[model samples]
Target: MSDLRATFERDGFLVIPDFASSEACEELRDAALRLVEETDLESLGSTFDAGGQRHGHDPWFLGSGGEVRAFLEPERDGDRLRVNKLGHALHDRVPLFDRFSRDPRLAALVAELGLAAPLLLQSMVIFKHPRVGGAVPAHQDATYLSTDPSTVLGLWFALEDATVDNGCLELLPGGHRLGLRSRYRRDGDRTWTDTLSDEPWPSDGWRAIEARTGTLVAFHGLLPHRSRANRSSRPRCAYTLHVIDGEAEYEDDNWLQRPPTMPLRGFV
Candidate 1:
């Protein structure tokens, strides 16, 4: 997708309309809700927050109810949840990941940016709860991913309507062109933190993307972006698919690195 590349370079992000069908969103949403219902909040792993909220239970690890929800709502820094609970199944299934992983359009984009082959490592869903605008402080994804600049791509697929009224994503256009910045700790209840830019540049072409269910937004990891609190009646939910050059090493620590209990192909 040269279009994807162009938008990424110019706006630091590209929103692909109707990239997923409404039926797909419904299916995933139902699955997530069911998992939440069948799960026990206390039995799940404990991750303590700064305010002592103890919001550590990942929806993915609670028996057959699964761990996808918690994986999506990852605990803040210093939490013991190592591997992403949803990585194994998503790595095995999810055609969306497969197509992007194998597509020449995406592959070439990675190469053009000087990234390795394979083009992706971790893929999972991210769901932001209503009235729950936790900290996703302004920072580059590179600070957390630790990959070569411009070599990584972050794809976010909205399964529900995402809008400014409900914490839709806000971005600074062309921010990726700037090299990496130092990391910083998050202030207040924000979950992530990073070194702030001395002369922070607001969006010369700032855009507040409000898309219907099934819209896909792809951007460089270094783009400075954040979403407001979800004041709307609905949860601002989206799926994040992290793709790096296949040739690139897995530099960050996330659930993709977890030791599988069983191999799908039985290689392990």
Candidate 2:
């Protein structure tokens, strides 16, 4: 295995080429497509984590069936409903998803990087549809995943080619040194707000992470990264697995804290 620790430390993100086999990529892509076709749009409100705690569903594209179709193209008669993403915690939905999320390679990297035992808490299949894919604003993963010392990492696996035209990821070099820029906290019973930093984004330091299928892009939680809307005809699809250091106490005030349903899974 390549020594990713040095590169990851230098840039705050490292793109490992051919990190997964072709068969693995194809299997994951097929599984994601199947889920998109079968998932119920209305039942998203009750999505659950592996621990069986309630987690809200992130919006999906629900695309039209065509070689090159917009995310929201309505002919009114009928369509093959496609989904854009499956998230907050989708690992336990199937054996495939669960296994992939906790792949041994991921855990090894976490250990090599000198991080504590890994605790995977969330997973996602982000689909950037052909035309109407929306842009994800520049932000740190720490805003959504708040840990005490903030030792979370994001592992993004490309299911297809990711390019600038298809909204490939753009990351700031060594941005993790700045730490978290936004904080999400509950106000009272139901309200929550994100307090973002007043400092301007380092747009000049941004660089595109154009990856091929089966590539893995591992980024630090505090790294500032973003992706634009997919304007090209090709769809951009990927799986995002978010992991955090398991050695710390997950605070009660953190917005994303979920009740433990089972023991945290780790790898050697």
Candidate 3:
């Protein structure tokens, strides 16, 4: 973890090799694929890519806006389960927030953050589909997290091999030092947005941090980052785990109306 710690502190992001194991990634990916395939929406919300193309968010469930989940599974609501649940259930009922949770790596990561009684704030899978057009405009995650910068970490676990050719992640070195920046809606994508910090970084200095299947990238909550479209004929599926310094709150009221799963315990 030393190398990861250094990279994270220096560049605001770090990629750990083979952190989760390919079998684990394959299991989760299979589950997600099955869920997407079996999804039968009653009132299916239109899925658009960041570029506003039809079926752009295709082959993946992109949750956005209010209580309506972007996609629905035919027989089960498991597809609506956030990425945090995936981490928890993957550990066999451990809530991922609990310090005593069974996953050693997660426990170590939580410790590394020096969190005291930290809260498992939010977890969601970001599925980047092949042929999905448009870039995820560079931005700081804190725009959506609403937490103290140092207390939160975004754990991006790759479910499939991610490469620059397939729109892997890119980051601006030391950008987290600038803290949270103003956010703005992109011209087309409603599910996500761009950040004002993108303009300040040296364009040539940006680096694509690619990783293998099972690789894990942990980054500061406020790190300015973005990903390109998956031009390859494969999907880039990933799960994001978020941990905050204290009990977290669901600032968005819409989640209250969604189908109940596990309760998000923290500040109400």
Candidate 4:
């Protein structure tokens, strides 16, 4: 654990192999598919393109932080609806997701990473569908979920094998030391990104992290990371959770905000 902590402190990211069993991964995948099947596609018209120029301003997108909402991919096959992701409040709304999110192993991981009072802020299941899975632009987690002192930690779990050909995560080692580059915040009904630093992310040191099923990759809030478009026939599915230190003051202007009825929770 000490070694793991040291490595994480140095590189700003750590990849743990087989953190969860194959059965657990399969269960989560099945649950996500069930949620998609139960959703009424005809009622949903919002197409979410993560890499779009006008990202994060949509009312539907901005309002999803406290509810379980499904976002669709830009492309569709005739009447067939392709979902890009299911997000924000799955940990609180869905039984399976809630159990997984509050698992003791995860709580231990958070403690080992040095967060004394960790608050789970957001959760998502990203379905990188075959042929249409869009590319995610390089950005930091703190941009979307900012805290005063910046104590956000991202936990990405691979539900299926993440390969280089299937849009696996690519990260710049030790890039968190470069500091926060920008912030995505909400102003009344509108949302915009504020640039805090002009420093360019290095191109050469980026490493593609190809993970096997059930692998958990934890990264710092300021770590620079992105994924390419999935051109393969296989789908790269992954579950993610973002946690912030309760000790830090959460920025009110941050894009993802929960209503007063729903307070943030920690893994018990």
The best candidate by TM-score is 4
Q: Show the lowest summed lDDT stretch of 10 residues, model 4.
A: 49-58
Lowest summed lDDT across 10 adjacent residues in model 2 is found at 61-70
Q: Candidate 2: what lDDT? A: 0.69
Model 3 misplaced stretches (Cα beyond 4 Å): 1-6, 46-68, 71-102, 148-150, 183-201, 247-268
Question: CA lDDT of 47 in candidate 1?
Answer: 33
Model 3 RMSD, rounded to 1 decimal: 7.6
TM-score of each: 0.68, 0.81, 0.69, 0.96
* Global Cα lDDT for candidate 3: 0.56
Local accuracy by lDDT, each model: 0.55, 0.69, 0.56, 0.90
At residue 131, what lDDT does model 4 achieve?
A: 85
Question: Using lDDT as the measure, which candidate wins?
Answer: 4
Q: Best to worst by TM-score, what's the order? A: 4, 2, 3, 1
Using lDDT, rank the candidates from best to worst: 4, 2, 3, 1
Q: lDDT by residue for model 1 over 201-242, one digit each (tens)? A: 564766678889988788788887776656556777776666
* Pairs of colliding residues, candidate 3: 83-123, 83-124, 84-123
Candidate 3, residues 155-266, lDDT tens digits: the string is 7888888889887889887988876675323223233434554446457677798888888888887787888866677778776666666544434421111124644433
Clashing residue pairs found in predicted model 4: none
Cα-lDDT of candidate 4: 0.90
